[model samples]
Target: MSLRRGAAHGAAWNFATAVGERSIGFAVLAILVRHITLADVGLIAIASALSEIGRMITTGGSGEQVVASPGDRTVEAGAFWAQFILAAAIAGLLFVAAPVLARAYGAPALSWVTRVLSVNIILGTFLVVPSARLVQNFGFRALSLMSLGSTILGGTVALALVFSGRGLDALIAQRIVGITFYAAAASITARWYPPAFPSLAAIGRALRFNIPMMGAAFVDYVAATGYVVLIGIRMPVAAVGEFRIAQRLAEVLRELTVFPASKVFLPVFVAVRDDPDRRFAVARSLVDVLAIGSLAAAAVAGAVAKPVVVLMFGVRWASSAPVFAALSLIVPAAAVYAFVNPMLTALRRPVLVSVFAAINAASTALAAWFAAPEGLLILAWTLAARGLLTAILLLPALSIGIGRPAWPLLRLFTAPFIALIAARVAAAALVPVLVQQSGLGIVAMFSQLAVGGIIAASVFLGTLALLAPRRIGTLLGQLTSAFRRVPVVAEPVG
Candidate 1:
């Protein structure tokens, strides 16, 4: 019952924020596309991406430490302050050095972008403890409201800026404003405050756990962002923008798909962490759910790749179509990781997981660097490889105490993949027939795509239900319940 309540609220908040932000974000992108060059947008992407790397490196494993150590308020506050100070210090130093870092990357325009994004670290610092407390208390509903209020504030400001000709400055300002609001809102919602001084002992313990987790987060960011950096340098901003759109669209689909399952599963993991039998049972159920959810999402993403891209971003972004299709494959792999990786953290093997993340990041970055074309295809291949590597590494670690996951569990993914392939083929076939000509008006193109995608999604969903009723049934039940009270949305993965 606690799980249901928490999840219900979390999903509601996630959904509202996701829908509002994404809709307004796409609008922001559309506005920017009309006003700025692709290169400018790409530079913004680079700055944001690099800041995430820095943030992860600075904060380290504090979050996982908090997660692992239950009900330790003093320790939690200590962890928050330590991470906050470190993140703020880094942000300050980085602000001064942003110009040099941009020069090092051969994109001097990124200096301002970097400086602007640095403030996010400070904003994030203030909110970390509060946000953590909310999640800790399972007050997802309140969390959702806080997040939406911030998002609406930010999105509204962004829209205004775009219309006022702020260009990419709108992007930077929107983030700062949004984070400020979010932090303030979450702080109010959680109602937990720290004293003037942080506990040294608590900081020490948090660092012990968080450093490795931070390392892992750093690697994850690097891996995901490496391609964007490479493209920014080797290709034009337009190309980078196209690629970013693909990545973003893919992630949106991923988040929407997994929100329901994760909410249902997080408390389950926390509860069964100490019970091997129950842990394994929960793990199996989660895997089944993830497989079904992921594949189903992938299918729809694949089917609508062309139409969705054109529908949302306008005709200029048609290049993103294939990239979206390529990225669609990584959704299932990410879903798998979401379940396995968290389980590892809960098992107190965060270091091992961090190591895995580092290896994955290194290999992915290397692959991106080596794959010179910088096309979505290469990016897709790199992500798929990373996903495969993560799964392989996790199986052995998870199997250690639980033996092996049931073999038949693998079969659950078969139907969804098949549906995805079929949808792609159908979309590919329909694109030419419906579109017939290139460079038509954006509306006409998107209309054709919408028609094609709806038809394809219907086929995909219907086929999955017919072939895998159990999975379909589980998904429908969650969706039904999720909408009944509040929308429970997932975090975007791909």
Candidate 2:
């Protein structure tokens, strides 16, 4: 129908997809954890992380080229095939290398697991074009539903496999099956097919756009993976297991809350590519929503970090509560960087974005070197530095391009910090009271949740309402309008 309608549908689908996918992953993980040791889990983490890094590197800049290139259905489909072939070839190599990589990491047991999980990379190549199309065209509704269906199917299969006592193999199988089904569903839903004559010329053109984007991607990979690498090198495998779980939980919250909005904003940038004023307005609104929502989640995470970890993963994971709390601070800070990155891309500022990313990468490495001795605390310092550096680097671009924020963007920091402090106080007060109870205490569970929820809600909402009423009103109106829009696609995918 309209751009807004497409965005609304896309947002709805993204949220549904996230919930479904993450639920399946969590379920599969919990079941697998029963049979596998922490060291096994650590290997799984390394494998998955490596797989992601592989995909990012091989595909490189195709994601940006999808937007930058102007092409008809034939050219687009051909380009998609070429990229898919490239990605599949790369994934195949990694699949074979999985064993070698595992041996190097001193976790040879992970070899098969890595190989099985590598199938996802191949499947991802096929889906990327359609996924980008759905997002580029604001077809979130279809995207989300396909994702949900894939997740449910994947989850059911994994649960059945777990029940059959296949252990980590089942988890690996779950990923392959889920990604395959997800891509098939996405292709059907988006009504896209690869053209027969895949173009070398198109590939070359796309590479011109994507190579720089690849550099940016590499920086991100290094920044993110550095933690996993550092943790594996410096800490016990069991400690890595704890940090991984904590990172997973924090990431789940982030993907659901932040990523959906970022996806919607990308198309917004595309639509208003030439109008700096409108682009800035859209960017500001997106940032405000992200900042406020992220703060609220971080507050709850900080407040209930102890109980949440204990309830979800068991007392063995109690240490993750603080680790998670440290990582939670990075979410809102990362949101600002996330918001601006897409805006820069839409405005043909990928090089500038790369520069900021490089700075983040260097800072992350330095932070890791210093804090590596302390486990999660090192990660915390790294994230804190990232948030600061991201904001500083973006300021010149923001001031010169996007209008100055209604409030200093840094002012958004107050709510999360305040919420974190308040939540920690609440946690310190309530944790001792509830955690002392006997086996399987629902009283403790609900009380911790209730107290945490109230404190987090009060602090996050009160701070935002008082500090930025205009931004709040704009967000409420946007959400309301988004709900009212129909979910039909107005433009052709081809």
Candidate 3:
């Protein structure tokens, strides 16, 4: 198959998988919130955040090394052993530091929660080789389906446990079950077994990649989770939970709308690295689709957040509406950074990526420190606004990666962004007028939704069409062609 076709297939499966996984996650979270206290959620959020930091550290180290390395030696063997060892070390550290973490958070229960979830670190490494090989081979369909299946099983177990009064255990159970199932299924699908003999040379090469990658990963982790850490410092546990939920919802939307291309783009970029025209075409495609899709998601989220919150999370979470809306509105800006990071990776530019990530991390930390003192809602909006403010800074980085000007990429997002702003303003003003009950009941929720959602959808579409009809046509044609000539690959996992 041609490289572009493979990328398209990869992107489609990635979108499908992201949609399915985040949907299940949202549903489970909504249900869990009903059964648990805000404090409970907050406690788990801290523990989960720490676990995520560990996962991110390990993720940057070995599995991705296997994906990035084009090998003469058995890089997979080295990567497998590298990740397994790293996972073990992180797990042990988490276990040992659980008490200190609990003390820092002033929650004794956090110790056990961290310890329980630490097992996931060890369990996660088991799939390193299988998952990497699938991604390296453009087997997104299989990988996507596999992840979706694991999510379904995990969500089912979580629901059952939540109903059975598992509380914090229920949340922890979901990750463990999902990782276990995904690892086992991925290994089976890929039919990959670790070698009995180790390769010292392969290990050295993998480490060469991993060392820089790990630095980038650490910065990436700080940028991603610094808010959680900094906010937790000044806020109560309940406030932290509320903030985490709003951020989580926006992040899920981001994965669906902004980042489906990220998973597909790294290898795609590498494949076309030597061909400037093809690589630029891929980059342009990313800018167009990611910006438009993200803007659309943002518009809807901003307009319908109230009614969606009412329906899924009840009036208890009404505060999250504005926060979610604020975070949602910044998707287009966030897309620029997301799109550039992978391109840099493909160009073997980890140091540059790491430097940008450092900038992102420092900015996030400062933003959180300033905002957390005011209120959670203010902090959410601050985070959202900074996304747009700092996004422009990435254009130079992209220009460097493509060895071309970044002005044209901005044009692709401009029309959609303008349309989004107008539609959102219209939707925001209309919702309050149409919904008299103030989103307290199902009838009122639907009323707000009907006015806001319809206005947002219609205005955004009509305005985008009016402004960029030809570009829309071209983008649609490209997307449609992607679904054609897709080859079936058995024994693949998304």
Candidate 4:
């Protein structure tokens, strides 16, 4: 298939996967909240955070290296063995350190929870090779089906356990079951067995390529999960739960808007790796499109965060609304960063990407530490600020990668940013009027949110259409062409 057609297919499947997975996850979480206490969720959050670090260490950019490399069975096998060994080691270390973590947090239950969740590190090792092969071949349809099935099975098991009063164990069980299913599905779909003799040279090459990438991944882990760790350490366990839920809601918007496209772009960039001009053009175009969509979605989500949180998680989580709203600003920054990072990586600039990620991680860690004492809202704001700082730090690399001045990129985003601001302002005004007119029952609150969202969307699109008419027209044209079933041509091999 042509690069365009391949990308479209991959994006469609990824979107389906993300939507189904997130929907099932939300349902499970909503149900679990009803059965579990905030402290329970917080405990799981701490365990999950630590496990994420181990996961980063285990995967350590090997999957991306595998995906970008040529179809070499030796390299694939080497990557598999490397990942498996590292994952096992990490799992063992996590198991041994679980009690120390529990002691640090003064939560005895965390020790066992951490130990149980550590199993995912090993499970993830089984998934890396096959999953990377699928992505390399653009086999997103199979991947999507696997993801959806795993999500459904996991959600079902989680709900059953919750009802059976398994408490936090239910969450751990859900993840373990989900990863197991995914590993099984990936193995079947790829249908490739590991070679008995993995090449040491291939392993060396992969490790060399991955060392810088792993540094970036580790930094990313700190940026993404460090806040939860800090909160768990310095604040009440309930506060960590609230912050985690808020972060999850904000991330949902990101998953829906930017993640699917980024997933598609990675392989596309790999295909066009040899052509700098083409790579730059593709990166710039994706940045423009993702920025417009992601920021607008973020604005709408932030505007209606209160009603959405209450509606999804019930009135008990009302306090989480502001946290969600504050964190929503991270969406646009995240979208741009996601687009830029893969483009850079595909162009063999992992070290540059690592530098940017390091700066982001360090800045965000400091911000989170300072903000933790103030409360969740301030911490949420800190997260937003971290996103902004990341974007700023990334500007130079983005300009170089795209072969354009940073100003043009900044200019491209101005319309969307302004539109988002105007939308929020409009929503801020409209929501109060609606609330005053109708009492704040569930129905009224939803109505107010609906009206506010409608107003915000209208303002955002109207402003975009007025300010960037050609860009809007181009997007529409692409959509029209996509629906018309254009002929597929094979992508140029790098």
Q: Which stretches of candidate 4 lie over 4 Å from their true place?
A: 437-440, 482-494
lDDT of 4 by residue, 332-377 (tens): 7778678666777888888887888788778878888888889888
lDDT of each: 0.68, 0.67, 0.79, 0.81
TM-score for predicted model 1 compared with the true structure: 0.88
TM-score of each: 0.88, 0.87, 0.94, 0.95
Error of 1 at 363 (Å): 3.2
* Residue 75 in candidate 1, Cα distance off native in Å: 1.0
lDDT (Cα) of model 3: 0.79
- Count of backbone clashes, every candidate in sequence: 12, 5, 5, 1
Question: Which ranges in model 1 have alpha carbons more than 4 Å from their true place?
Answer: 259-266, 372-376, 381-390, 397-403, 406-409, 434-439, 474-494
Number of the predicted model whose lDDT against the real structure is largest: 4
When 1 and 2 are scored with lDDT, the better candidate is 1
Clash pairs detected, candidate 2: 1-490, 9-141, 10-140, 13-144, 61-210
Residue 7 of model 2 has an lDDT of 61
* Model 1 / residue 50 / CA error / Å: 1.3
Of 1 and 4, the candidate ahead on lDDT is 4
| TM-score of structure candidate 3 | 0.94
How far in Å is the alpha carbon of 257 misplaced in model 3? Answer: 0.6
Model 3, residue 17: C-alpha shift (Å): 2.0
2 or 3, greater by lDDT: 3
What digit string (tens of lDDT, one per residue) describes model 3 on residues 64-95? 66677755237788777666777799999999
